[model samples]
Target chain A: MNIKVAFLAILLMALITYIPRVLPLAIFRKEIKSKYIKSFLQYVPYAVLGSLTFPDILYSTGALTTAVCGTVVALILAYFEKGLVIVALGAIITVYAAGFIL
Target chain B: MKKNFLYGLKRGIPIALGYIPVSFTFGLMAVTGGMPVWMAIFISMSNLTSAGQFAGTYLILHGAGLLEITMTTFVINIRYMLMSLSLTQKLSQDMTLPRRMLIAFGVTDETFTVASMEHGSLSFFYLLGLITGPFIGWSVGTALGAFICSSLPEALSNAMGIALYGMFIAIIIPPAKKSMPVIFIIVISVLVVCILRYIPLFSSISSGFRVIISTIIGAGLGALLFPFEARDNNIQEMRE
Candidate 1:
C-alpha cells in the first residue's frame, strides 16, 4: 500500500469503527424507561462476555487439549472469585505447563 | 475527581496487561506483512480495536479496495452499537455530550465489559482513567513488536492468547454464581454462539455478527423472562 493510500485506509477504518461506538451514546442521552429494555441492558454484559469467551478461548492456544486445560483452570480460579489478573495468569501458566506435558 | 480517575486506572491495570500480548502480535503481523512500523502504530493508536483493525490491515496489505474494507469493518464493529446503547443506561446523569463522545471512542469489548460490570453509574473521569492505561499499553506494545520485528517464544506468546478470555471468565463467573438469571443468560449466549460456530450452515456468519446476535438472544430472553422491577432499573439505587 502506498503511504498516502495506507493513511487514508487507516483513517477510513478508524471512522467506520468509531461510528458504531459513538452513535448510540450520542443519541440516547435520556435513561431508557422501559423495564424490558433496562433488563436487557443489565444482562448485556454477561451475555457479551459469555459469547466472546466460548469456542474462541478453545482455540486460543492453537491446541485443543492445552486450550481445554487452560480453560478449566480459568473456570476453577474464577469460580473461587479470583481477581482478573490471577485468573488470567493462572490460565496462561496452565497453558504454558500443558505445552510441556502434552 | 482525582481519586476516581486513579481508582479507574487501578481497575484498568489487568485489562491493560491483557492487551499487550494481543496488540504485540498485531504489531508483529502488520510490520512483517510489509506495513511500515509507524503505520502499524498509527492503526493501533487510531483504531484501538483488535479484530476490526486486524481485518482492515490485512485487507489493506492485500490491496483490497476501500469499499471492501469499509464493509468488513462495519460488520465486525457493529456489536459496539449494542454495547454503547447498553451503556446509555449506566452513565451518571452528570455525563455531558462532549464527555460521552470522548469516552465512546474508547468503548472496546473489554472496556465495555469492565465498565458495565461496575457496581453503579459510570462517571466521565473514571471512564477516561479506565481507558488510558489500555490505550497506552496497546500503542506501546505495538511499537515494541513493530520495532523488534522478532517473534517472542512460541509457548509464551500462545499462552497469552487465553489472557483476555480468562479475564472475561473472571468477570462473569462470580456474578453468574450469585444470580441464577445471570447464569441463564450466560448459558443462553454460550449455546447460541456454539451453535453458530460449530454448525456448518451458520458458521459463515462473521464473528462480530455472531456476538451481536447471541447477545440479543441471550439478553432479549432475559428481558422477557425476568423483567426488572421499576426500582431495579435505577442502577444507582440498585448499587445503594
Candidate 2:
C-alpha cells in the first residue's frame, strides 16, 4: 500500500470511530428520562462485555483446552475479588501451564 | 482535581496492563501485513479500537478502497455510540462540551466498562486519567511489538493473548454475581453471540452486526424481563 494511502486510511478510520462515540454524547445532552431506556442502558455494559468475552475468549489461546483452563482459573480469581491484573495474570499463567503440561 | 485524576490513573493500571499484549499482537500483525512500524503505531494511537483496527488494517493491506475502510470501521465501532450515550447519563454538568468530546474519543470497550461501573457521576480529569494509562500502554506496546516482532516467542505471546479477555471476565463476574438480572443478561448475551458464531447461517453475519444485535437483544430482554423498581435509588445520578 502507498504510504499516503495507508496514512489516510488510518486517519479516516480514526474519524469514523470518533464520530460514533462523540455524536451520542453531543446530541444526547439531556439526561435520558425514560425508565425503560435507562434500564436498557444499565444493562448494556454487562451484555456488551459478556458477549465480547465468551466464544472469543475460547479462541484466544493456542488451544481450546488451555483456554478453558485459563477461563476457570480466571473465574476463580475473579470470584475471590482479585484485582483485574491478578485475574488476567492468573489466567495467563494457567494457560501457559496447560500448554506445558499438555 | 489532581486527586480525582490520580485515582482514575490508579484504576487504569490494570486496564493498561491488559491492553499491552493485545496491542502488541495488533502491531505484530500490522507489520507482518507489510505495514511499517511507524504506520502501525500511528493506527494504534489514532484508533484505540481492537477489532476495528485489526479489520481496518487487514482491509488496508489488501488494498481496499477508502470507503471500504471507513464503512468497516464504522460498523465495528458503532457500539461505542451506545456506550457513550449511556455514559452521558453519568456525566456531571461541570463536564463541559469540549471535555465530553475529548472523553468520548477515548471510550474504548474497557474504558466504557470501567467508567460506567463507577457509582457516582464522572469527572473530566478522572476520565482523562483513566484514558491516559491505557492510551500509553496501547501506543507503546504497539511500538514494542513492531520493533520486537521477530524476537518474542510464540508461546509467551499466546499466553499473553488471554489477558484482555481475562480482564473482561473480571469486569463482568462481580456484577453478575451480585445481580440476578445481570447474570441473565450476560448468559443470554453470551448465548446469542455463540449461536451467531457457531451456527452456519448466523455465523456468516459480520462480527460487527453480531455484537450490535446481541447487545440490543440481551439488554432489551433484560430490561423487559426485570424492569428496575421505581423505588430503588437510580444509579445514573450526575454530580453537579
Candidate 3:
C-alpha cells in the first residue's frame, strides 16, 4: 500500500476507536438508571475480556499446546494473587520453555 | 490532590509493563507482514488499540478495500463503546466536556478496569496520569519492536506474544475466583465463543461480530442471573 493510503486507513481506524469511547461519555452525562442496565454494564468487562482471551489466545503464541500451557501457568500464578507483571512473565516463561520441549 | 494523581500513575506502572510486550509483538508482526516501520509506529500511535489494530492490519495486508477496513475496525472495537459508557458513570459531575472527551479516548480495557475499581469519583488529573504511562509504553514498545525485529530471534518473539493473553487471564482470574457471578459470566462467555467457533450454523458470523454477540449474551445472562443490589459505593452510586 502507498504510504498515503496506509496513513488514511490508520486515521480512519483511529476515528472508529476514538468515537465509541468519546460518544458515550459525551451523550450520557447523567447517571444511568434502571437496575437491569446497570447490572448488564457491570458484567461487561469480565464477559468481554473472557471471550477475547480464550480461543484467540490459544492461537496467539503460534501453537495451541503452548498457549494452553501458558494459560495454565497464568491461572495458577493469578490464583495465588501474584501481580500482573509476575503472572504474565510466569506464563511467558512457561510458553518459552515449552517451545523448547514441544 | 497530588497524591491521587501519583497513586494513579503508580497503578499504571503494571499496565504499562503489560502493554510493552503486547505492543512490541504487534510491531514485529506489522513489519513482518510487509508494513514499513514508520507506518507501523504511526498506527500504534494513532490507534492505541490491540484487537482493532491487529484486525485492521490483517485486512490491510490482504489488500482489503478502505470500506472493508473501516467496517472491520468498527465491529472489533464496538466493545470499547460499552466500556466507555460504563465509565461515564464514574466520572465526576463537574467534569467538563473536553476532559470527558480526552479521558474517553484513553478508556482501553486495562485503564477501564483500573479506573472502574476506584472508590470515589475519578479525577481528571488521575485519569491523565493513568493513561499517559501506558500510552508512552505502547508507542515506544512498537517503535523498539519494529526496529529490532531483524535481530530478535523468532522463538523468543513468539513466546513473548503470550504475555498479552497472560495479562488478560491474570486480570480476570482473581476476580472470577472471588465472585461466583464473575466465574459464571466468564465460563458462559467462553462456552458461547467456542460454540460460535465450531458450530456450522455460526461459522458465517465474522470474528468481530462474534465477540460483540457473545459479549451481549454473556453480560445479559449475567445481569439476569446475578442482579445488582443497591449499594452506597461510588461505583454503584454513579450508575444510580
Which portions of model 1 miss their true places by more than 4 Å? A1-17, A24-29, B1-44, B47-151, B201-206, B230-240
Residue B4's lDDT within candidate 1 is 86
What lDDT score is found at residue B236 in candidate 2? Answer: 24
Candidate 1 per-residue lDDT, tens place, A1-102, comes to 787888898999999999989999999655446778667766776777788788788987889999999999999998998766678779989999999999
Order of the predicted models by TM-score, top scorer first: 3, 2, 1
lDDT of candidate 1 over B152-173, digit per residue (tens): 5654766777776776787788
**Model 2 per-residue lDDT at B16:** 91
**Model 2 ranges with Cα > 4 A deviation:** A1-13, A24-28, B1-40, B48-150, B201-203, B229-240
TM-score of chain B of each: 0.65, 0.66, 0.67
Per-prediction share of native contacts kept: 0.82, 0.73, 0.73
Q: What are the models' TM-scores?
A: 0.62, 0.64, 0.70
Top-lDDT structure, candidate number: 1
lDDT of each residue in B120-180, candidate 2, tens digit only: 9999989999999999999998898788865657766668667767767776777767788
Q: What's each prediction's clash count?
A: 0, 0, 0
Q: Weakest 10 consecutive residues, lDDT, candidate 3 chain A?
A: A29-38
- Please, what are the lDDT tens digits per residue for candidate 2 over residues A1-102? 898998999999999989988998878855445667667766766676677678877877769999999999999998886755678779988999999998
How far off is model 1, as Cα RMSD? 6.8
lDDT of 2 at B70: 80
Would you give the TM-score of chain B in model 3? 0.67
